[model samples]
Target: LVALPHANAQTDPLPSWNEGAAKKSITDFVARVTTQGGTDFVPVPERIATFDNDGTLWTEQPFYFQLAFAFDRVKATAPRHPEWKTTQPFKALLDNDMKGLAAAGEKGLLQIVAVTHAGMTTEEFARTVLDWTSTARHPRFHRPYTELVYQPMLELLTYLRANGFKTFVVSGGGVEFMRPWMEKVYGIPPEQVVGSSGVVKFQIGASGKPELMKLPKIEFVDDGSGKPVGINRFIGRRPIFAFGNSDGDLQMLQWTAAGEGARFAGLVHHTDAEREYAYDRSSKFGKLDKAWDEAVKRGWLVVDMKQDWKTVFPFEK
Candidate 1:
């Protein structure tokens, strides 16, 4: 067992994380796994760590950030389609009626996504998302949505990488949506991002330029069981460490913990409402109920947002 870092250690890698069981657990796990002759020793080549994006890395309360992007796309493109002004979901969306949009539900949300997220070539869609993320601000925080990422988690990412861990983002958000800025924001590159995707096609444009066209149909949903399938398809290796915030990530965590050798699984519990938002079982976005119980039952580390994190967002520091 490697010695734990002192509370006032000058080289503390996770200063934003409170000195507690959660932080100690993470440090100890890394220390043990990295020790050359230790029973838990893991080779650098096998140091795979996967993280869920939304609430695990950043804020996902009120609604999902991608849904917000879809809504914004609808408004931006509404001028081209006059019918959307009178359509059920579009009208509700354009009207800025939260209740009306909620009532529209999954089908309605899908209609909005199909219109806004598809039809364009992958390059075109990438530019569109880039533009939107650059200017979009969170509704309540009023800061750019990118700035809403949890500070402690950012440090954790760096700390893991410093210890020779290869980090990968496995999110439920659109792969294209995240690929554009993930490297810039999270230190994880595009090739390492695995997420929900839509059908795309290879085609030659009118100008004879080869391109991939985005289709409006769903190809994969990288949530719940889909996460593991994506891991298998894209990563080709089992992750030894997994971090997530909701039940959707339960299967991923289970898969990680079940791996051979010393495995670690962690959950981020959103228990702070003042600094961030407080939510659990009943939350519409990033529901954390079943997974919370599962974490306890499985002896996984659960980081309480309010208690375990000394600072929530980067801006708070």
Candidate 2:
């Protein structure tokens, strides 16, 4: 078995994290919440911790991994739809015209996602995502996407769980897309993940087997304002702890902070271009402008990746 990174001899719960204010805050918060008879002591079931996936748990630089998956899907399915060869966005994609694809805008992206992600059974879609994730590698790292997960965040998740905190991934990524691999990668189960989703219908297939067919229409987005709504609708509890890395996750942090008692809201600020990436405010993807300001204003923890992390990825030696 591959030895997963863990705390050093059980002495430190977050060994991958460096000795800093960010690390100290986490440990202090955990201690306060878990200390029996303490004023800040929280019940086990009340320790809900929600984390954003893309830039928080893993890297989402250049672009989101899910969008990359969509692009690959476009290529794989292009052969079946001959008309895609001449279509605007499809033609742009076929020609590897990044500018042209960008010109197509959000409308074009939604069209691509609708075609690629829908019109298949949930089981079929799950298999497709699993197969792609198994072989697909990040462009810069040349490592499997799953291997790109942040080691410090993994340690943080484990640390929180060890302290009776129930961790959940509340991301803007598709729920079905994340469900198939979350347990293996993040140790979070399918039901614990809340994300954007498209419409799906339950019906009998040709073999008389019941199946959930994915539809092109979007059901609910789990970003920005939709985040709190999704949490309320699905998770049924206000998260006491929340971690994210972008403006898109602002509402989640806000919602978590609004909850009563011992709330911890943290943001992972990417500041290590040498080791990984250095981006914020201006980044088109995972932009951290408003949220950064809010974090400062609210006295929320803003973890500087370069300073707070002793290691970046688990594969690092």
Q: Using lDDT, give the best candidate's number.
A: 2
Off by over 4 Å in 2: 1-9
| Pairs with steric clashes in candidate 2 | none
State TM-scores per candidate: 0.96, 0.97
Report residue 242 deviation for candidate 1 (angstroms): 0.4
lDDT of 1: 0.92
lDDT of each: 0.92, 0.94
The residue pairs found clashing in candidate 1 are none
Cα lDDT over the full model 2: 0.94
Query: RMSD to the native, candidate 1?
Result: 2.8
- Per-residue lDDT of candidate 1, residues 1-317 (tens digit): 66566645558899999999999999999999999999999999899999999999988977899988998888888899899888899999989998999899999999888888899999999999889988988899998788889999999999999999999999999999999988989999999999999999999999999999999999999999999999999999999999999999999999999998899999998999899998889888999888899999989999988999999999876
In candidate 1, how many Å is residue 211 off? Answer: 0.5
lDDT score, residue 34, model 1? 99
